[model samples]
Target: MADSPLPDKLDNARVLIYSHDTFGLGHLRRCRTLAHALVEQYKGLSVLILTGSPIIGRFDFKARVDFVRIPGVIKLHNGEYTSLGLHIDLQHTLKLRESIILHTAEAFEPDLFLVDKEPLGLKGEVESTLKLLKQKGVATVLGIRDVLDAPHLLRPEWESKGAGAALQEYYNEVWVYGDRSMGNPLEGLGLPAQIEQMTHYTGYLQREVPESVPSKHLLGVPQNYLLITPGGGGDGVEMVDWALRAYELDSSSLPHGLFVLGPFMALAEQQAFRERISRIENASLVTFDNRMESLIDNAAAVVAMGGYNTFCEILSFNKPALLIPRTRPREEQLIRAEKASDLGLVSLLDPRKGIDATEMHRALQALLKQSPPRELVADCFLNGLDKVCQRALALMPRS
Candidate 1:
């Protein structure tokens, strides 16, 4: 491992990150975090992130890190997707994306290529790029979260999609941002033993919050305010509506509720929710904030949809969380929330089971009254970027 050809100098080192942020902010955020860490740790490292998020420009990024935004697409209830007027079809979008990625690779001539979440990219968009990088002798890696899904669910899906084969042949390393004792993401991928040596459990990546910020919205809220969040707000409307209704029906249980309706939530849905919750004196609604870490840090408890990023934030702040995960499309959130609940890290409520005023009230009461288990808070801070940076550095071409 020590003999690996990582670059020693930070200057002139180029790193490319590929993040397929189709739906929510998790993948993009993770990539951004990794980019920031690399640039900060290595003074002259330049990082370029290629992402498909519609709201890429909304957030601020570090100095050495920049992103190229691909055409956006949204998933509909019928399981079909439509583009944001930028492309005629998903195929066109993929072609454009491929061109942009390849062009970026050619221009940047990256020393390392770190792909977030998607192993083979958006339906194998990165296959050609991976081949190009291999030919060019660029180090390639895959960054994955702790728990992708149940083994049974993931096995057939990956097999059918040829993701397993891609993993076996393409990526040089598989970095899991979680502990394997908790769960192993590659267990069912059925790769050869040589592939296992390329895997690393890099713990969880965490966002560090400053001691104070000048933002008045999160400044010293009243003692007992419950914080409600839905990550990117694309799929959070249902959870937000349920929480508002729960508060409306049982205002006595929840004295105050602060709803951070994510920026991406539909305008009509946001308006209706705001109007409905306005009548409830205990509830106050606001739009998204990049400084959500501060808000979560000061909250009494959290009621949210179980996105991996949000779950990590809640755990980092040691806030008691009530997770209402989405089912049907992807069971990632459901699997995580259930496992966390089993470990007593949080209270998982099934959206299918129906969240009534009674259940909400009971759960909130218990969380606020009881102390969250200490083990739930054990070593949850995973500063994985440093390790990843070191690994990438090790893989870089030595002078």
Candidate 2:
């Protein structure tokens, strides 16, 4: 792009990221991390994120990175989606979202396009945009998390949406932010050999928390206390509540439990959690923190619901984490937790089988006594940001 006589700086090369955020903050977080990483790597590089995440404004952004907030949609428990606040029909809302996305890409004229997860996006909202970008010779990338839904669920879901076809035609490269020994996000989809060859395992994304940021003391959490979280907290009520329940059972054993309830959790449930916190002596609560990387950094050990970004943070920080993975909604988290536990990267509690308060306490105690688990640290790669930046720059010439 810099070679096109546009601007002198190599930062003239830009990247456009799309996140079809149906539910949680995972998609948005991953995109923002990548945007920040790329911007930091190049002097004049600029990154624009097109996202439907409701809480996108809550986080601070880097100088060369910003976001365009697309109209949001919420996924219902019944698997149907509704406009976040608009009275318009879901179809009409999607049309509006599509227009904003396509128009932004056209105006931004990025040298590279990174589409998160869903190849075609929600109901194929990003399809036209993908087509137009490719026609303009944009290097389109599909940046998927380590594990998508289990193969059985993912295959049919992709087939129904015709995502396989888009992957074959629109995208130039498929980057899986995980190690292959973990699991392929596209396994069992029966992708053609060419599509498979286009895929690259970029390893787990590495996250860092700046040391100068406000400390855990701000949350009333003492040093050496357990840090517990459910990233974005909408679907994490079960796990978050379980931590509170465990604390209630024995505050002495698990003193000073710090719970960062994500903003997406239902108000009533958050209020319920607050009521429990008021009754408990040692535990404190904060609704949300944009810089959760800092919280994870200072953690004695982490108890997290296994989301991709959370897992990445745990891996990068080398925090001893206990995962309580949700079985329903998609088996991706469950599968990831199981494998990570097998590798001794972290431990897990299967929500389906439902370990009780005593078992939860035992896990917490074990974590305090033990060095944070890291049997496979050398085996897995967490330097994905560097690789992504390299691949992205190579797509566009510097000179």
Candidate 3:
């Protein structure tokens, strides 16, 4: 990475990231990735991530990157959110979150405020914080993923949350972490001309193999395996079931499979997978691993839900991948999978068409021998981190 131009002033610059983190590990993980990258690029830059993920403590942070844990909220299957642990009602919980966020911004006094995905934040919890930060002259940015839900679903949802108004009033810029070749995530949102002008496409964020690698003995990593992950595994039961069934149906044709069931996956689901994996000679299960990049780096191929972070890693590592994107709650993954598949970056097996075990088996086998992504796309696709750093430098005020 290029060195920051204003290193002397960078020591005093700080970036605060807000990750709503209501459902899966996606928000927290993406924030962590950006935090790490920013600190690495700018030598004394401090990145503080404010998150509501219950398992935020599980992952490691770099020297200049840290996190402040707010009260947790969990999104239900029915699209409602409830406090993850507190017995307080949703209203009380949201108030508590709002207060915490506002106080953190006041205390931290960040040079830049980056909000992940949610424009107004979870139930508008970050609205007060955004307003306060704006008055304090903090450069506010909205970092959205490559694809949000379908336009129809996202438009109504954003309208209900007053996202458009929030963007127009508070945020200084909107950063789309994707390439235009893939698709425009905000295609039909109908933002005003000014907001559209503020938008910048930073391509896809690229991941690297971590500097430190844990011993295989410590992680119990199997040899020459295929990595099958469903992101946080909150809604991954069906994907796991299909993969296991594929193995049970025919294991002789496939390589050893390492399943990383995420921490948020239910206890019952983990136990069931454990029992099933024990019976299958070619399959093994791990509940969760913070060092996921290392595992993906060593894997022969990958099968995953095609979430943003995982997709970046697959492209970064140049692994042949088979994506089975979920269509419920949001079509983000499905949209991503379709676009990447069309570009020949990854193969897609749409669940909307019904995922048959036989088809899954065939896909996995094909994936193991398929060409890696690097052969197809230019190197510019993974240049998101560098572009983001450039934007950050431009946004920060010089001393």
Best by TM-score: 3
- Cα lDDT, all candidates: 0.78, 0.85, 0.88
lDDT of 3 by residue, 1-399 (tens): 434453433777899999989988999888998998888878789999999999999988999898899999998888898999899999999999999999989999999999999898998888889888888888999999989989999998888888888999998899999888988888898878888889999988988766675535235656678889998999888888888889999998888889899988999999999999999897888888887888888899999999999999999888999999899888999999999999999998988889888988888889887999989887677788888988999999877
lDDT of 1: 0.78
Descending-lDDT candidate ranking: 3, 2, 1
lDDT of 2 at 106: 91
Model 3 score (lDDT)? 0.88
Alpha-carbon runs more than 4 Å astray in model 2? 1-9, 215-219
Pairs in clash, predicted candidate 1? 6-394
> How many residue pairs clash per model?
1, 1, 0
TM-score of each: 0.92, 0.95, 0.96
User: After aligning candidate 2 to the native by TM-score, how far in Å is the CA of 154 from where it should be?
Assistant: 0.8
List the candidate 1 regions with Cα displacement exceeding 4 Å.
1-9, 214-216, 373-381
- Tens digits of per-residue lDDT, candidate 1, 89-155, equal 8888878888888888998999999998777887788888999998998889988988787677788
